[model samples]
Target: MNDATTSPADSALATRGAALDLLFNVLAKRVPFDDAWDASRPLRALEPRDRAFVRMLVATTLRRLGQIDAAIQGSLNKQGQQLKAVVQDILRLGAAQLLFLGTPAHAAVDTAVELAVARKQHPYKGLINAVLRRLDRERASILAEQDAGRLNTPDWLWLSWRKTYGTALTRAIVETHLGEAPLDITVKANAAAWAERLEATVLPTGSLRRAAGGQVTELSGFDEGGWWVQDAAAAIPARLFGDLAGRDAIDLCAAPGGKTAQLAAAGAQVIAVDRSEKRLVRLSENMARLGLGARVTTVAADATEWRPDAVVDAVLLDAPCSATGTIRRHPDVARLKSEEDVEKLGRIQSRLLYRAVDMLKPGGTLVYCTCSLQAEEGESQITNLLYRRPEMQVVPVTADEVGGLSELLTPDGYVRCTPGHLAEIGGMDGFFAARLRRVG
Candidate 1:
């Protein structure tokens, strides 16, 4: 993808080349898009605008992959014989442009054909050209034929949502995932002032919401480290602990620390622990950026086996799961994760839940949360926790605590914020959180 290219056309072509390669890895190898992009030399070499384009191209291809494939397959002449995965990927990139991104037919098609040649997929050049042209010419009809809400989402996710949330709510959730999530920030101080200064909406829970896209680091307060990007929904679990002034709190599984930052900012003496040393370093750096380094300590240890020297006042285990709740922000989740992944993550979540409660002082709070829509990862964890640990009892998240938003709470009073919640104000991540007390 990198070459001695100066002309605008050549640069754009090279950008598409990078995108094609990135898309191939994500689709063919099941590599996470962010990881693939981080590891891509050509993408890094491109100018910022080109880099953005490449990212958009691949993300859009993955996001609308089902629809994109439909357009390509419907255009194919042969019924049974299918294009190679790489060839289908090229057409997907082109179709994503023509069908969704508003990329001009000539530019999208020509560059995709070039990408075919670059990827040594030149044999299917005419096929790529033909499929893309037909998609462009019949974009409206092809679009009309698509059930994007149903088609784009994986069967496992769709069925799970339907079974859990029911067909109507599931529709709302999947349709919402089709779009990109907006930016939400938790300001270190003066949320109203930051909201006004940033021209962002102050969400009821105090996280500032802004339509502002592009580089978050370029934003005004970012350099000053006044705020950190955290979804309004993702901000909930951290707030459940209330004022942690002088209290010792542990953010079990904290990395790229958002909740850990919240705990520290709330005047808690926070220990942010994660198994990955490299991730802990990143979290420490981000903490420094926010000027909360003094209040926080970083620990690189497997939380399952690691325990605090003494039981602390609070423990927040945002146990990792399928992450199906944050699909709007990370579209790759729908493709990257499977049912088996959820089952495996459930086992880990259970282990982490037990470890988290063990690290909590008696009568102290332990908040267990996950960014997953799956029942096994959310509700079931709490049920099992109560059954296994006779010392523990559900504290039941109250509506008053979450900005008087009762809908954010489930019937059993655990916090269950889904994509359908706050739909009028651009929905939040699908997050489930429960606060428990060690009654023993």
Candidate 2:
């Protein structure tokens, strides 16, 4: 089903076929890319190398979908618009190969045409072949005129970011999203020692950094549970509560438990609350791997309604948001998330925050955080909370609290880690955390 160069037996055809299905699902059906990726039977059947190819092909197509479509429209003379959605994705995948992955033109064009046949898209094979060939030929010019950062970013997000961080920084954030993020991991202790052993660079926030795209399980520390994968920015919010030893801490919305691990590792008597029971099981499994299960308890209930036996020392609400901040790693978020989604999540985050405060001790700390680049979900939520709850005063994050990076601190004393904050050393995810003290 593929060309001689690609080999009839090579996984190229199977991989692209899977990519098309996943892409069609994500773009047309509005299914999340990760969900689709996980549920894809064909994807699961491939060898790891081919699986990685499928992932990169689909991810690259999603990331540059704007430019790919623009190039397609240009090549199609508006005629290709009549092509089937899957066929369109086929062309998009082909364009991604030619322009981004540096796939050979013959292989890229041939496989695309062949892919159409394999998928019963034979009628549009001509269109697919023509469009991809044109893209391959004009690849240089197509790239030359493209404002990838602008083109790839959704209109709502581009404007929202401009208003929030101004043009230059917004551009930086968009630029950061155009590429893949490096792998960052948080260790239980002796991060420096782990860094030396793994030959990984220790980021300023003390997270270890290495080139991403390897099987995480294959890493040295996976078996020992010495470290777990986490973004440098994600490891920060939990640290805002300093000296958690023997203090009570609640990690609301804590599923898949990255922040929960940090809290328990800090010696906090942690109650990790999440809305999903299934995810709680996963969190418990992770804590066990980290040898932190004894220090943490999992609660599979709505954090707003689930209170501890007594008001705890601190609460960390890593509330759900549109997740625009993770665009670098999950480029599909740029295509999947909307301004309306941000508005909706902001309401939920606020509700969760109000409840988290109720569970805090009189002099306890409450750190509200979100992995959202939208101010509505981060800064605005905190602002409104302070207005409604007078007792919840901002304790303010100092430079030392976040690796002496004073730029991470807001004038109002919150911690705002944008993708552009640590751009020099492979930027971190965008995270907003505000430490508050309930002293009524």
Score residue 121 of candidate 2 by CA lDDT: 76
Error of 1 at 289 (Å): 1.7
Badly placed stretches (over 4 Å) of model 2 are 1-10, 79-82
Q: Report how far residue 363 has shifted in candidate 1, in Å.
A: 0.7
TM-score, per-candidate, Cα-based: 0.97, 0.96
Clashes of each: 0, 0
TM-score of 2: 0.96
Q: How many times do residue backbones clash in model 1?
A: 0
lDDT of 2 by residue, 272-306 (tens): 99989989999999999999999998888987677
Q: Residue by residue across 1-440, what tens digits does model 1's lDDT show?
A: 34554887788778888887888788788898889989998877788878888877787778888888777778889866577887877788888899999988999999888878887887889988888899899999999988998999989888898999999889989888788888999988898889888889998888999984878898877878899999999999999998899999999999999999999989999999999999999999999999999999988999899978999999999998899999888888889999999999999999999888888888899999999999999999999988999899888888888888998889988999899888877899999999999977
Error of 1 at 194 (Å): 0.6
